[model samples]
Target chain A: MKLTGAEILIRELIALGANKVFGYPGGSVLDIYDMLYKNATKITHYITAHEQGAVHAADGYARYSGKPGVVIATSGPGSTNLVTGIATAFLDSVPLITITGNVPTALIGKDSFQEVNIVGITMPIIKHSYSLRSACDIQRVVREAFYIATSDRPGPVLIDIPKDVQQELADYNQNFEYSMPAKTIKIDLHNAISLLLKSKRPYIYAGGGVLISGATATLLKFAEKISAPVSSSLMGVTAIPYDHDLALGMAGMHGRYAATKALYDCDLLIAIGVRFSDRATGNKDKFLRQCKVLQIDIDRAEINKNILVDEFLIGDVKEILDSILELLPENKNKSWLNHITKLKNSHENLLWTSNNSLTPKSIIESVRSVLGETPVSTDVGQHQMWTAQYYGFTKPRSFLTSGGLGTMGFGFGAAIGACVASNNQRVVLITSDGSFHMNLNELATAVTYNMPLTIILLDNNALGMVRQWQTMFYEKRYSQTALDRKTNYVLLAESFGAVGFKVMNVHELTVALTKTNKITDKPVLIHCLINQDENVFPMIPPNGTINDIIIR
Target chain B: MNSKKHPIFLLVHNHYGVLTRVAGLFANRGYNIENLSVGCTEKPSISRMTIVVDCSESLLDQLLQQLRKLIDVIAAERADPFNSVSRELMLVKITHSPESGGQLLEAINIFRGRVVDMAPESLIVEITGEEDKLNAFIRYVEKFGIIELSRTGLTILDRGQVSLITKSNNN
Candidate 1:
């Protein structure tokens, strides 16, 4: 059959099982939008207020659904706007297909209106990019884009279709075929298993790869079978239930004291799907000073990129874990477990504050208790660390935050996406005032969709994380950390036609949360004014070793 | 760390802005490209680039991996200095006074170079050889009052039938 390039692209997306596309339209993409309008019934096109929001929504959807998210935008500023969101997806390994409309083939370099070399601009960040010059290449490009975006270490792939190409006629062969390369899994577990057996204090450090490969169940079984305690990176917090006896919660800068201490004391470290990021290991030399490291990751390049490992396995985390589970005997390390328990108990009493001020910790605890298993997304900074430390994530994909890039303003669009992807499941956005102000424009998106999202705004009236750093290290020279704007968040929410509540104390917060929980039709924002002087604790200062951790 | 000069070769799709992408990758990472040469391959659709960088072995490995990860790049590998066949082209213009013309000609013949073009006061000599050999030729020509010089950086190929095309296909 013969069809326009735009029609073929839409048909290909539908064939690939993509039911939703997030985009904002422009002149260069008019033909594609026309085709999308015709096929609106088959696929829902979400028109976000900005291109960044559109891409972020797609990113959120991909993270939530474990499938490739689709996004579309026009050329020039429209395509450039997706850069941050694309980088966010790329750094975190979220699969996304970003389609941008370019100027016609002839006018690509002529400086025609809305013409930009988007493929060149995003080459470094994206997994792959294709600039289509002919209509006939659309089918193959679309297939390749989808395949590359979701295969192996997933990341964003850009496809630039010129305006003329979209309007051009192409022979659409429904039977066109492409085969994905077979994934090869090769691993030798002898050394790793032997190390695990030989050590007195063996610890398991899991990362996002566990969740990405769906190895959480296998990880839990392996941890239980080996009787080893588990600690997670920020990205891996959801890999094991927080309340599990063997789970030591998050590790690294801003990590739980017990978790960091366990890492410091362990004799053998079995790291799975972790890159040993600097933030996760304050000082690489001191992270596992006396421990033999056995690292497992799907990406071979990541094995020794940051911290050297004594033994390594390069393959899918779930498969590797399954193999490890099948190997060898059942053993117990009672003394190590006892030591961990004592350490956990000793540090347990250090997390509370004496004042009655509404804190992020208390707010996170309340939210977790009230909404068990509800997916929570957060922007970067104090609130993110607080949520990672306090929220109990019992399942994978339950907590989504920008880990690698630490992108602020990421949660708003992602929360909406999670809500949509999870079939209107109540999603929460735990964001600080500094981070929330960056993407508050997205509040209109929530109102437009009427998504069941709750915005837990932690308004400290300053860039809390940086301010804390300055206060600690720079003799309290605040600099530009303070955001003294008079923008009323409650009134802002009301302006967007959403319910708003202001809570000053724990009692008021509880009342606001209770009241907001009852209302389901519209999104609600609960503004909790936290103390400006408050800072996230158990912080390891920059370039400091894990041993140099400050408990206060 | 001992920084040794390594010649890295890449076969990429012949597309616009691919050079920018390759150069940008190095620029962004703060890796210095000491010398670079690019041209079309036997297949017009493919282009080959040779980049010489002075860095440690591990850093070189990282650069190779990053280069291979690029979308347009089909294959990337480091050319062994001892085992690989490498050559660079240099064009030098020397002062052609009657007093020095004879010495310049003798030197060019010894270096197996040719006088490609001649003007009244100068002669342009072209020499093709390894970097060290070209440097020697330039040094000898400098005594004759060289007027100008241009050199294409190293272009290398592995010894025997092992080609980048076959290597990329095998992967």
Candidate 2:
């Protein structure tokens, strides 16, 4: 259909699978807004109080959907306001298609009121960006922005359209021919198979990229065939079924003592679709000095990016894995499996003995029993670590947490997005009290959409992670980590037209979860009043090696 | 003995003011660049950099050991000299004039590059490869105006061969 740039904006959004956008119109984008108003029935645009919230909402949408979430805003402050959200998405590896209204083309670079070079400002933060220089370029830019957002390792892509471009007329009916680069990541199949056959202690450590590239089945098959235990990054929980004997739980900060220790003692490490972040490595010098590392990642940049690998394969996990399975060597390391089981048993026993307080493991177990393989998202903090440690994730797309950026206040909106995207499949958000407050306003959006997510608020009433560090390293000199203020969350939930529960004990938590499962009309918040001094132990302090882990 | 090539992870404070400073340092040093990757670390205030440069093995080691002395650098380490995971990101704008569809498809098939977007007048082909591969593709398509190009430096890992973090004691 031949249409103006403004009409193309609306039409392209529909083609990109955008049913709704979070944004507010302004003078700079008034023409586009007028076109949007006419097509309001086909698209829903929410006018948020702040552009930051709008961008974050879009980010939230992308996190759960694994698609480019769309956001729109006016020029100047409106475009600049989206920077924080764009940067957040950039850091956390989110796919967002953010469209910002720019000053009229002629006014650009003339310091027109509310004019800024948003494309330049955001270039560093986004995967790619575009400024609509002409009306004829709108369709191509929109299509390419989506491509960039969804390609390779997904991230935010911006399209800055000037006001004049929106008003200019153009033919918008164009089919975008899209094909992603398919470079065959070279895998040394013979060597990979041989190393697997030779290892006495072998383990599979999976990460978020496994889910991104749809390699969960291949990973599972490889693990089962080799009888190797599997450890997951925080984002990798869902890659393997938690009940499987080979599943060794999460590895990193707040990871199971057994899992972390197993990583230290393992002979061979098969890292698939994972970028060993600092949190996962603890200290590079002590992370994997003895083990032969086999790294498989689609992005060549990731191979040997941080920690060293003995054999690096630059290919999609699924393809490389299929090759390994085909090049099988007939050798089994029984002793390695036995040792891993022994370590796991001892670790489980230790966790059982250490249940002196309301720990994360207990909470995760409770939630799991109620919501098996349900999608759970978490904000960053001690609570995030706890969720990672305790939650037994079994299905792909089951656990959604930000590991790379560790962006606080990411869970609440993401939970809403997950709920919306997954057809009301109980999206549970495990958030810290501190993080919840940062984007607590998103509760209204959840209520507006009537999303039936169950939010578990770990109320330690402090920045627990920071407090733990201060307590251990700073001689208990409590700095700004203490959150002294209090707001009755039960009352807050009620105010937001959602169910609320305050849990202090296991029984209370179980009861609240049961209640949550029964009621699906609106979201639910269960505030668990946990110990104030709880610390995530076996922590490799920053720059400290695994040996220096504080085992209290 | 030729100094062995090593891996270096340089963590710098995250600031727009310093990216140019770092990139300039590498560009100005006349170092035979191999690979460089920069991304945000777990901490918001710092960025983790993975750089692979082939020099006299001794010089590479000595240079990294000295990188730790910079104030902007939070930490610098020769992550792996022998085994490591590394990759680079690139965006190449290749121009294939309207008359060269046959040549364009041939080039695409050869490099395994994808035609992400195209106008009636030109085509933008996207390819990710070793520096040499990209360079070769660029050479083949030089007839088309190289409108623009951007690249993410490089990122690397040194744990075991397969996983993000190794299960070994070093991890």
Candidate 3:
């Protein structure tokens, strides 16, 4: 079929399993808007108030759907506006395909109106981006962008198509095809297996790479078969069931004491499918001082790249693990397991109840007791920390919190996305009042999707984490942390055609959760007014080692 | 494969600061490169780069791919590997190194390898390979001194791809 570049691009998107696209029309994208208008029934186009919001909405849809999120923006500011959201997806490793309209090819770099170097602006943040000068290349670029966005270690891919290109006619084939090259770098399987067998106190610290590589089963089997203890990074939670016997919970600051201690004492630290982010390592110096680290990751730059792995294996986690399984010797490390269990039990006392009046941990545990292994997402802040500490994410994609970007307002949309992806699985979002304000407009999106999402507003009336820092380090010189003005969340939910409730205690929480769980037809927002001035304790001071942790 | 093959060596600063500039150029231009390795040179602050690509002599033009931007990558050149005396070290420990002492010794002799370590029951043999030497050694050592082995993946230098200073001064 003969079609315009805009039509061809949209058709390519449909071929890539994309149904919904979040964007807004502008002068530069008028041709695209016209094409979209003509074929609006073929694809769902969402007009968001802001380009940033539109990209985020698309990101939320992608993260939730396990499908690449698609967003569109016009030239200049429309494209620039998506900077924050695109960077957020880049940092959080979300699969997103952002298409933006550009100035006409002739006007490009001629100081044209609504012309900014969007391709240059987005180059650093995205895995890959292109400025389409040729209209004939639109189909190939769109197809490649989707492929790049969904490939190994998924991330956002941008396509900046010139206005003229969109209007130009082309022979449109409704099929997109591209093959990613198989990894050529090989890790010696026998050697890696022997290393595992030789080390007595081998421990596995898995991360988000496992989820992207689909290596969760291999990770679980490797840890279980070796009877090795597993300490997961925040993104790694979904890769392994939290309730598993070998699971030692999340590692690093705000992580379970046992998990951190295990990391500290481990003889062999096998990091699988994870980039060693600073948060995962309390301090880079002490992360694996006593261990021979075996880093199995797909990115070669990451191997022996950061935390200094003694043995670096560059390959997909799934492939490496399978090869290692074939070569491993049948030797059990019973004594090493017993010693680790002993060390793990020593910190059992730290798991005691927090004495703080409005403990975030208490609230999370209360919600967990009612929700029971349900997928939860949280926006960034002290509330995020509290939820990570208390939320039992027993399954993969069950705990969708931003780790790398720590993006505020990510929880609401992600929860909506999770709900959509999992066939209306109960997705509860634990968000602070601060992050809630950032993207609370997404409540409208939730309403539109009719997602079975429950937004739990951890209303402490202040930016809790920042306030805690102010109290501890800044001598309590409070800034704009306090949002004491009430915004009546019940009315907010009602305005969106969803049920809203306020919970005061454990009984109220359970009751409210039960009621929300039943109302799957529409989304529900729960405003749980938590105690103000709450702090996420057991913090490691900036640049401080794990041993320097301050436990309150 | 009748295509011309070239082995390029870019002696750069040991600083990892140059990798992005070098890799970005190739990625942006959509060049399909093969077998690239970067590591520290004999000098403490210098890095040796080994890149292998196949194309016509015009392939040298690909150096415009960010080579000028990198201040740390002192120079880059094509080298002939056949004439260069290249070597790679691999430590292989076999299971029967302890029980089959005669077999282990014979295998080590065949590969001209010396036992680097012995833990009563295991032997670690250090062997250096020149081009196809390591592959041949592995075939022989697979029977005795090879329980585990770690190879510092192929690093090479050219016979005549010396710095311009020496050649220019000589000329």
Ranking by DockQ: 1, 2, 3
Worst 10 residues of 1 chain A by lDDT: A347-356
TM-score each candidate.
0.96, 0.75, 0.76
Q: Give fnat of each prediction, in order.
A: 0.47, 0.00, 0.00
lDDT of each: 0.87, 0.76, 0.75
Maximum-DockQ candidate: 1
Shift in Å, residue A50, candidate 1? 1.5
Give the per-residue lDDT digits (tens) of candidate 3, residues A1-552. Answer: 778888888778777778778787898999888877877788777776567768876776776567898889999999998998888888777899988998898998898899998867776577777778767888887877777787666789888889988988888765546666553554566666767877878888888878777788888778877778888887777777767777787777666666777777778889987888877786787567888888888665465445666686766779888878766655567887787677666754155455654456667877788766677888898888877777777766667777888888777766765666576677888997899888888777677767778788888889888898889899998998877777898898899788899877766777888888688777788888777756776676775666777666
Predictions: Cα RMSD each: 2.0, 15.2, 17.5
DockQ of all models, two decimals each? 0.53, 0.02, 0.02
Ranking by TM-score: 1, 3, 2
What fraction of the reference structure's interface contacts does model 2 contain?
Answer: 0.00
> Considering only chain A, what is the TM-score of each predicted structure?
0.98, 0.92, 0.93
The CAPRI class of candidate 2 is incorrect
- Of models 1 and 3, which has the larger lDDT? 1
